[model samples]
Target chain A: MKIKNILKGAVFGVFAVSGAAHAADVTLNALFMAQAAYSEDDIRNMTADFKAANPGVDVNVELVPYEALHDKIVLSQSANGYDVVLYDVIWPAEFAQYKLLDDVTDRIDDKTRKAVLSGAWTTVEYDGKYYGMPWIADTKFLFYNKDMLKKAGFDHPPATWEELETQAKAIKDKGIVDYPLVWSWSQSEAAICDYTTILSGMGGQFLDADGKPAFNTGGGLKALQYMVGTINDGVTNPNSREYAEEDVRRVFSSGQAAFALNWGYMYNLANDPAESQVAGNVGIVPAPGEAGVSKASAVNGSMGLGIPTKSTHKEEAWKYIQFLTSQKVQNKYAKLSLPVWEASYSNPDVIKGQEPFVNAAKTSFAVMAPRPTMASYQEASAVLQEALQNAMLGTATPTDALNNAAKTIADLQ
Target chain B: MISYRKTVTAWLLLTPMIVIILGVSGYPLIKTVYYSLTGAKLIAPDLTDAWIGFGNYIRALSSSNFREAIWHTTYFAVISVGVEMIIGVMVALLLNEVFVGRTLLRAMLILPLALPTVVNAMMWRLIYNPDFGALNALLVQLGMLDAYRSWLGDPATALDMVIVADVWKNFPLVALIALAALQTVPKDLYEAATLDGAGMWNRFWRITLPAILGPLSVALVLRTIEAFKVFDIIYVMTRGGPASSTKTVSFYVYQEAFAYMRVGSGASYALIVVLISACLIAGYMYLIRKHGEA
Candidate 1:
């Protein structure tokens, strides 16, 4: 009888402990990239803030290299590897199509939805549902060396493609720089991005309203012609074809190029006296468009935060997302990235040191175009990059290259 | 009856290895074959269990990109392997002779082989950089040209430049193999040839050449197989750029699978390549067997 009573007491104790453990607070895992714009300390501080605001929740953040994040997401889709996922702009539509992301339409409040920039909001929308929240709003701007422009006797940045060529030639003729323009035209994702800026400025479309390949239209040929003409006219470096975006920024920062087209982040990096030779001699402006063709020159590029569809801690993840994207938190985020919240634009802290970006963004945002949203965007962009490379290298005429790419894309579909 | 029992016991002893080989290699091969006949994507719900027999194979075979890639891959393999073999033999011959610091020279020669292929590719990319690369800087300093030429940006030179990088990374392996073979060659043969009043050319042609052919053929086959599947260097340095001049079969397969996310087509493309490779390897084995008999 004593042994039986002892067993009954032990069983009661085990059940009581399990019940207590089940009542503990929830924890959520987040996967993000350790890019130049978002550091580990930023995530750590944000997690701390979120934890303080919600005493019953804990957050775990896993940061990976930018190059590995895409493959990681693709591999982790089935397992819902993380409760929250940070992804590039190109990913929302594709991830949503594969049912890898949660439909957070109801979770986002109307006021919060209306607070983000329209261009950034569009990146997170697909098939009439929202899959993510925009975290950073990015777009390219024309960066020029003020000393080189002054040496060439130009008081302002070029406003048109014709004027750009003329100014570049003047700078080249004066021997201010061997190449007046340096571009990120390497045949990879960067090349396609650079091409999109030119294509949009020339009023060309990558896909028509019917969603067919339309980049080989008249405007497309003209854009390619202008790009290749720069090399033929001795205004841009022949080495441009081999350079990625960082390489172009490196050239401009070293006071070697009269002009460069890069993302807004380049402004801060190029002005640091320790890293740049022409720290204070830099001017930022809108990228030039062809005369009477287009006023829009830049493309919208950004990353978003989302919850995976299979996550079990949806409530906790949503709470953390709201805390991280709040105006106060985004205001702090602006130090490392452009603010996604439109109201943060007028924040004195945001505009204090980044006047050029703020001013340029006002115009750029109004005209920013996005790359085509497709499940197979990687393949599509690759075809476009190859076509541009073929035309630039003189291996194929612009018409032939684009036409071939059109056929290939049709096959891919 | 006793012999039959012995054979059964032997088969039972080999069961674990057979099961392991089937589980590791055979399972994946069969799954790949099955997937090639189905409509599959690399990610998510699109990776379904639907049958579309031979459709992916037909589409890939008819694609222009695949055709161009086949030609480029073949050309790259032939050129890179041929050049690597010739240079490897010459280097091996030179290193085999008694000289000052022979051991140091031997170690230095294999350094490129020891370095990772990805690192070698990146180093070559820096060297080929037109604006600030060592190649252009050195050429300009030597007054060889008035301007820096874009080596990788031009279509005509991109493939050749990639080939040079591949050769630099792989030729050392072939040289090391030839060096090992050279040590096996008897010194008395050279002495015998010299006593017979044979010239240096005759001595080398009659003795060294024949003695090395056995190992040289093995090296050639190995290098050829490796060159045909070249991907990392191409992926890094050129990415088959300047007009798809360097896109090898493996790179094409990778683009289809990961970039295009078309697992079905990628599997079909891979199977076709495997078929071709199997035939080539069979021929190589036949040649090796024939050489051994000779």
Candidate 2:
């Protein structure tokens, strides 16, 4: 009987060892990109700091290049199992189809919940369920050179579409500017973003709140027609044909265009007198309309961190998420002026901290609105971009272009 | 016993080569043919188990972009190959002369060939830059036009300029082949031509031309294949732009497969391109065989 008991104990010990093997410390593999936020060295140092703070937890972080990140993560994340990752907010629907992300609403605390600001946190919520933790927030606004506008007899930024067009015409007449408007009209993603803003602002929408086709209506056509007017009225350049995000920013910084519509990130360069030809006078203004009447500026670009549902290290991945979105870490990141983490903006140290960039978090984040959440947003954006491209090219009247896009979206639905 | 061992050693030496060719060349060729039939977007890194039939090919056939690309690619191949052959033969004759720097000059001539396609294209793009490029400055200095013109940006001039970049990049290969073929020609034939009171032109036409036909034919086939699949120059310079004016078939295939992620469609389109290329190669082979028989 004593021998048998000893044998049973040994068997129990073997089972215990196997279970402990499954209970080993989880090491979460994270993919992040640093260039947009800070220099690679700065991000690595920050990451090391985060690692030191959490001992015994191994965090494997991969720094993906900015241009290649969007396509790479989207494709790989679709292949079933992954631990945790950073992804563009535009891509959640595509990734969620694989059922690979955790719903972290329960795990989030008041500290984390309070850190995110109004309209920014909405990007992570799809179908009223949170699938990701917000990392960075970005949206579109107007970047006008204040001195140029001042010289053109405008004391303030354009108050409405009429004011902007009038100011551009004035700038053109004075022979001070080569082109009044310069922005992306290329066949890539920018074309979509620019078009959607114009369409939404004009009371045109890709889909109604009920998700029915809505772009082919009067409002959509008016939005498109206004762009055609800009192109034809010589406010926007014919060279806008060759324009892209880089080209627009380059030309705008060089003082070639009077008023430029660009994202909040333009603040970094526009404030730099060395990189910018029109630096000291650059001004940021919300694309103008009566308050609460303008199509709320659609959420432009934001990135989120989330753990895949099939990850080997769910608990550790959540901890890393906690670290990345924490006010402490976000405050450190805010030094780079990336517009990441709304909570960091309110932190006195983050606001007062001097980094290489001229800090503009307070101003840039002031009048921004979140992008609408819809499953079919990707398709909708494309339709709107096509309309804008057509309008800008003068191939179709704006009304015709918007109506056609709306009809197309309606057909798609 | 020694002869038997030598034969065994020769076969043994060739075994690794046989394995390599079968693995790298043969396997890929077979895989490509299979992939050509299936609608596969090689760019969509997000695929698990998705298969579509000749649907991609059907879509590619119906697509206007594919048709435009085929037309542009054909025009490019015919023009570039014909021009290269004429220029190559002339350069070969020039190099055959006993001149100072003849050896040195010939060595220098191969420099373009040595430079990578990507590097060569980058240099040319700068040369054509309208703002501060060397080409524009030279033209402006010479009073060729009233204002600085963007060579690659103007839709009218883009295709022609790209063809020029490609020809400049590739014509060296043709010249080297022609020169090598010229050396293999028996000196006695030239002597006979001279004895017959044939002038320089006649000697070049009758003896020199006939002697270099094999290598010239080979060069032509290779140039034609390269020109048909020309993607790099167009991609670097125009990106099928100033409108979709300079888009070649290969670039179109890349856009369809990679950019748009219409994988099955892209696959079929790519397969179609390969089939056309195969046909071209087969035709070249038939011509070479017929010429040899004659």
Candidate 3:
């Protein structure tokens, strides 16, 4: 009886050890945006690759629209939710202030920092702390239909905003399309991006030296005037007031508009014969500058992947984020969004099929402008969006609209 | 002894339901009330101790944005519910008739009601698409429109368009309820009305109207509440764009608490909305009681 008991105890010990090993498996829930930049399938596939390398870690991915991304991250803060989350460039200040994201400053080494583009670093930094890994280095580019330009007797895409307007006028006169330009000027963050691009191109400043509202004057006023002028002149699609990036893509892809201001993702999609009607006729350029202000314009529309502070599986989440943001993974999927790594810009594989995109990226990235980084950015951006819409809809003049926005934003501060 | 045991057993049976109600509804209501008076942030509710009495409520009331949102909500509720009531009764009256395809038509009415609101909103979004939307295409083809125009994009028509979508999805529910009520109305009343030399309109106003008023009022109250708290359809369709023309009180509250993380002000806003809803309910109940007595 004693011998049988010993053998049974030994078998139970083996079972206990195996159960402990099995319990080591970690399941992580990661959140990503469904629209623009990298596609949902690309995110899932990259995660799958990460899982293959790290056998013990399993990831569950959830994708929401860009408009919902900020709220989702903030709402899930206390729920112990989202081990890994994709965040926008404007969120780091707010997130860092709330301590919603883990400070991974030490995790990013000097060698890695040196290799990554310096501008991309700003996406994940706030108050000198790194909140995440910058994943998408994106900007809005000028997309034009080559056929329409040719039909309008223009040999080259416009090099400046004035030239672009002239070209648009030519296209409209030739009856190539009813509206020669379409923009994602909807009352969302998208409108802010386009405004920032134009504002920067016109040498406008978002704030004065003391961080006061300054956009209502100087180049800011010009940017709004320029946007309103396009609509008033019947060159810009009036429906653009209601359009987001996707709507702009649809209108441009369907050959309804000759020129569209959209993100980098539109390039490959607009050129794909399966997706766009005028695929081969697509032309890419950096958003045009003003004559004396800038050579090219772009918004620092990058995004990052971060580990939520509430995550219990922080180590595993960091591993997944690192794998996703690594140069190899980013370069492989550079068709939709360019890599943040400086060397990837010169990689033949990244540039082979999309030469114009690569060339435009080279110029645009250098001049990419940022929206104001503040904890109240969301509210301020809302005010700006409303102001932009009111001006565009002719409910208020640009001066009055921007003045109101400045006042509201000043009150928020 | 038997009576005492019965009382004890009943109390034991009711305890679980009481606990559940207190846990789900009571706890949250109390917490929301507590948070409304404090300057609490959404991220860390426990850390807040700044109790600024009624400050948030004052701010919310004085804000022009909040006032606009309230107006939008009221407009949406009144128009959508009013249209829904009219169309619902007409459809119910039509379906209640002894027609060959009555049963099939009744089943088909369930299709719109059965679809999820998000799916309905998405479908309507496509139908209203500026470039290739069916509505624009149809209107242009029929010569009702000179060109394709943005329906949801324009502030003048966006809310109305959303109301149209809401009405399409919800009128079937009212129709179903009204139809059920119509079945319970006796044939004798109508025959008596006819014998009394009543016209078609008179019979409808005197006999059918009174009989169905009770169920219709219930539908009215339910739909009014739903429409006043409208968020999902607007979120899916517009995200309250084109200059926030379609932004309702609930969407405003959502933006405050979740998007902006201002939990304190958000709670106050929510309570204000609740107060408005309560007043509406009370008004409805008073009217309903008067009708019942009459």
Best model per TM-score: 3
Candidate 2 per-residue lDDT over residues A1-413, each given as its tens digit: 99999999999999998777657645667777654444466556766887798776766767865434554554554454357777666666645554547788888777666757645566566666678787766655677887788888889877666677889999999987867887666544565556655655666655677877666675556655666678788888655654566667777888888887766656566667887888776777656543345623333456778887767678878877777766676666663335455645555676562332223334434544333454445545555655565566555666676677666666645
Docking level for model 2: incorrect
* List of clashing residue pairs for candidate 3: none
In order of appearance, the predictions have TM-scores of: 0.90, 0.78, 0.96
Query: Which fraction of the native contacts appears in each prediction?
Result: 0.67, 0.03, 0.79
**Best candidate (score: lDDT):** 3
> Over 4 Å off in model 3, which ranges?
A1-24, B1-9
User: Which TM-score value belongs to model 1?
Assistant: 0.90
Q: After superposition, how far is residue B94 of candidate 1 from its true place, in Å?
A: 2.6
For model 1 the local lDDT of residue B198 reads 94
DockQ (model 3, Cα): 0.77
* Candidate 1 chain A: worst-modelled 10 consecutive residues by lDDT: A65-74
Q: How far is B247's C-alpha from truth in model 2 (Å)?
A: 4.4
Better of 2 and 3 by lDDT: 3
DockQ leader: 3
Residue pairs with backbone atoms closer than 3 Å in model 1 (clashes) = none
